[model samples]
Structures are given as structure tokens and as C-alpha cells.
Target: MISLKKNEKWFWSGVVFIEMILFYSSSMTYKQQTSVPFLERYLRNKPLAGSLKHFGFNYGGKYQSIENDGYFHFVEFFVRKGAHFGTYLALGVLLCLALYTYFQKNNFLKILVPWLMATGLAAFDEFHQGLTGGRTPSVVDVILDSAGAFTGTLLVVVIVYFILRHKNMKKT
Candidate 1:
């Protein structure tokens, strides 16, 4: 039996909640998944479209035109990948934070454990997607997810380093 400090308990609870959310989202059907991108496209066409177009995003594929056809599938592809990256990025950050908080004395464990956990989750996520009817799980996606996780963890490390540097400077 392991007893957790109050903050540790809260962090672990949050991590579990995030995992549930990700799992639930992964369980959505193909058609159900499209709904979010559809809504995003609709909203982008509204006033926001102009701002995005100015930045050369053009969801309609007019700016850089990654795909010639104006079909929403082209936009949806990028949107989906972006979602994968963003979600895993968040997962990585949260996991790193939790591990860092719990293992303040072990600096190596703080980084290594979170990366391993995030990598494992990314692999599991792709495997779960493979079981879904409309989803085709790919190793490429796992790579992307792992990349996002690493990016997030690296960001945390950089931020923490800066903070510690600032704190040490203040003492001088």
C-alpha cells in the first residue's frame, strides 16, 4: 500500500482524468470524429477565416494549397494530425509535471520516467485506434505522437531551468 501526499494525490488524479478523456476521444467512430473538423471548418469560414488566410493557412486550401481540391479532407488531415500532436503534448507535459513533483530528489527519474510513460501511452493509443472500425493505426502516427511528447517534456525542462537560474541569480 502506497500513501501519497496531498499534492501527489491530486496530480495523479488529474493524470488519470486526462487518460480517461484521451481514451474516450479515441473511442469515437469515424463519422463522429469528422464532426469536430467539420465544425472547425464552418467556424473558420466565419470572420476567423480572414485572419487565418492572412497568415497563409487558408483552410479552404487557397493560400499554400497543400492539396489542389478545396475539399475539406485536405484540411481535416492536418487538423487531425495537429490534434494528435497537441493532445500528446499535453499528456507529456502533465506526466512530466506529476513525475517531477513526486520525485524531486531524483532528477534523472524525473525526465526519464515521464518520457517512457508518454512513449508507452502513444504506442497504446495507436494500438487502440487499430481496433476501431474506421481508424487505421500507423507507426508514423506513433512517431509523431512521441515527437510531440518529447517536445512538451523539453519545454518543461527549459522553463524549469530558466526559473531555477533566475532564483539562483536572485540569491547573489
Candidate 2:
């Protein structure tokens, strides 16, 4: 049997929790996931509406379906993409922390493994989306998600390197 310290347990638990959320959300149809109604209500006050009214994103043909949705959809587009990036970023960080001991001596693996795992999750997410109605899976989204994961794992590597360097300086 494997033994885990308290911190390790926490990190692993977080990874599982986030993974569940990602999977659950992915399984939902785009219509089910839409936040437009909520956005509509919140922006009805006009002050907030005016500020973002003309805000636009020059999304490519891939997003043509949403391009005509006006301001609310524009905000939703960003919020959705931001969710994709941020969720995977957190997943990458938690995975790296949970697996740190296994890759202690191999700095390369320390960065690579978590990113790969997160990318795999992103790929699976796209696949799941395909199974849902009104959802079209995009390769571009997987790329965006992979970038987020890479950023996260690289952040962990840098932080650990600095901490080790500071400890060595203290010893000398």
C-alpha cells in the first residue's frame, strides 16, 4: 500500500474534485451551459451594458455561430474560454504538486507529465462535447487548454527551483 502525507492527500483530492467538475460540465449540451440569460439580467442596468456594448472579438469562421449574438455573447465567449484556460491551469498545478515526489530528480518530467495529463483531459473534454447535442468540439480549444496547463506546470517548476536555490544559499 502507498502512504500519503496530509499535504499530498490534499493535492490529490483537489485534482479529483476539479476533474469531476470538468467531466460533468463537458457532458452538458451547449444550450444547457449557456449563461446568456444570467448575463442579460446582470447587464440590464445599462451602465455595465454601455461599457461592454460595443466590445467585440474578431473571432474567426469557427466562431461565426456566436459572432452575431451581439454583446452578451461576446462576453460569454470570453468567459467560457477563460473558464477553459483557468480550469485546466488549476488541474495542471494540482497534478504537478500531487506527483512531485515521483519526478523529483527529473525536472523535465516534472514539467512534462502534468501538462500531458491536463492536455489529455482537455482532449477528453472535446470528445465528450462531441457526444452532447448542440456542441461542436474544436481542436483550437484543446490547444488553448494545453497552453494553460503548460503555464501552470512551468510555474510550479520555477517556484520549486527558486525555493531549492534559496535553501542551498542558506546552507552555505
- Which candidate achieves the best lDDT against the true structure? 2
Error of 1 at 158 (Å): 1.2
lDDT of 2 by residue, 1-172 (tens): 0232347889889999998998899889878999989988987653455656545544434433333677677677888989988988898888888888788889999899999999998999899988988888888889889989999899988888898799889999
CA RMSD per model (angstroms) = 5.5, 3.4
Q: What TM-score would candidate 1 get against the native?
A: 0.74
Per-residue lDDT of 127 in model 2: 93
Error of 1 at 149 (Å): 0.8
Judge candidate 2 at residue 107 and give its lDDT.
Answer: 91
- Which candidate leads in TM-score? 2
Model 2 TM: 0.85
Candidate 2 residue-wise lDDT at 4: 29
Backbone atom clashes (below 3 Å) for every candidate: 0, 0
